[model samples]
Target chain A: MCTTCGCGDGDTRIEGQGAEGWHRHADGTLHHHAQPGAHAHGATDPRRLRIEQDLLAANDAHAARNRARFAHDGIFALNLVSSPGSGKTTLLCRTIQALRGLLPVSVIEGDQQTRRDAERIRAAGAGALQVNTGKGCHLDAHMVSHAIAQLDPAPGSLLLIENVGNLVCPAAFDLGEAHKVVVLSITEGEDKPLKYPDMFAAADVMVLNKIDLAPHLSFDEAACIGYARRVNPQIRVLRTSATTGAGIDAWVDWLAAGARAAARSATQRAGPRGVVA
Target chain B: MHELSLAQSVIEIIENAAARDAFARVRKVWLEVGLLSCVEPDAMRASFEAVSRDTRAEGAVLELVAVPGRGRCPSCGTLSALAAREDACPSCGGYGLRPVAGTGLRVRELEVE
Candidate 1:
């Protein structure tokens, strides 16, 4: 029995199978355990240990490494977060199809089960990898690092990490993405931002998807944007409809600009290679 | 919701610290939870009990310190206590309130043997 959350301890696998690389422990160690009760510690005197550390320090360290790797490779990584059934995969499909030839785009799909989303991404003519988090609610930086190592995209490419569709947990766990793009469909309530402020505050861009059905539904666009702005004044809002291809151009433009900036920074950092010492 | 995972994370941190500090078992854990941290302390305690079984921290006392949320209002330049993230500034009633404190989730100290 797993000690945390009472969920059965299932090993996290990449691409729907056992991963050969070392699995990262929750404590950020890289060792395999023989069993839970196999080891025992010697009796010692009672004492206090002043461990003043952030619980997320290990995850944050992994995220820093992932961020550095992305910068070095010039990969503009965008983490897509939202509630389940918010059209994240549909948006990704549309994004991949639009930028297929113009730029090299790849996807890392995270979910509790199934390779269906990854398959859809592959059908869109972009390389895709699937990560089954098992009972985990959100993907952490270490998991993303493993996925990136397995699916090594070309330098100066776009890496779209479709996070496990969750608004709360993903906001707290940084996956080393350059920016977090939250997709909130109009079909959902406009008060979502106010209810889930942490997700909105952490997001750089809020994609108000399914706007094509706005005329049919009674969704309030202004109120939704207003609520989001209340939490995050600097958040960029984009109205989109994946079904009719509306507002896709704006999304693609934003992504292209991010990619250009990343590539430019990488070039500037390289600073005229081949200067032998 | 995610408190279970957070509880698991706490256990992992404590376990690692135990190994490094040569502690056989943990007697109590003092956790500092922020008011705006999105973690329910009761849920966290229940999760800790469930996830700490067969580990060094099993049956350990969970002492939580609730930290009040504080935000700085850009309009009035006043730091006030906030009940929620969407709360307006107490002085100016403005929306441009930046969070200043009480968002931390850390293991402040531990009593181990």
Candidate 2:
């Protein structure tokens, strides 16, 4: 159970899935073989199960399902991750406003408490759902799947999942997103990338948020980008300011491209077998 | 920390394996922790103790196998041991070393009855 969200206690509820929903094992155990003589091993002797399985195989399986569902629905899902107070919500709000009428945009806001971010997103003219992960530092695939099942963003739309504001754990938990976008504010030190290299390495894009404050703050932008590239050479960096709307267009364009690609892929998958529609 | 959740996952895996293998209880668990796997053995042990309560894995001895991180230098094509992801290649002194192994966490073997 996550100490932050009280999640494993079966209290966190997703919309449309009443309380006690979302992967609650009554016994907190999954029993695959009930009978003692089910396997070939002797019933009296001890047996060694050479289970060479990854610790996160369960989570990864859920993520695969989520990814397939997203692909089939033609929805471009982006998992936004960053440290607390890195301006993730503000940027999300700005993004919602920018792409509201042109393209349907929805948000899944994650936090330890409060519907404040969801309300802010709704005020920005986009569909929003709040998932409070009480004591959980990161959002897992199961939680995201439940949230998506309830939210049901329209096909060919963009779903922005703002992960719990943490740099470490979120990197390990895949939420079935098309890409993981990491936000780094200029207010934060440039050494942030080096300090939290896992997040930087896991992310597909690194958004340098609050760039308007770059002049006022002595943040080494080059060093920050350098550090990020050292960890992830393929990561794309976008400079943006939610307050001044400096790089909103580029961000929106990137999102649009992803949504378009998703739509195209979905169409191809839905087409006749072996036919490239 | 997320180690709690990870420990819970380990227990779940063990429980499922026990059921499939028809084991009464788990006597021991052998885990492979890679150098770049981002898991601390001490934290994992503490979390396992906390989450394995009342489960078949309770009181089970956890044997941790440490796997060293290995990377191949893209520049010199030399394979060497790496302690960190950003470690430069030892043979070539190049930063572009691709990790080849020691980045996984897995339940290698289990002793059960």
> Which candidate has the highest TM-score of all?
1
DockQ of each: 0.25, 0.25
State the C-alpha lDDT per candidate. 0.83, 0.82
The TM-score obtained for chain B of candidate 2 when compared with the true chain B: 0.94
- Model 1, A230-265: lDDT tens per residue? 888889999899999999999999999999889888
True-vs-predicted CA distance for residue B38, candidate 1, Å: 1.2
Clashing pairs in 1: A3-B51
Name the best candidate (by lDDT): 1
Encode model 2's per-residue lDDT on B9-112: one tens digit a residue: 99989988876778777877878776666665667778888888899888776766666568888779999876666667777677646778877889989988
Each model's chain A TM-score: 0.82, 0.82
Question: What does the i-RMS of model 1 come to?
Answer: 12.8
Stretches of candidate 1 above 4 Å error?
Answer: A1-46, A272-277
TM-score of chain B alone in model 1 = 0.95
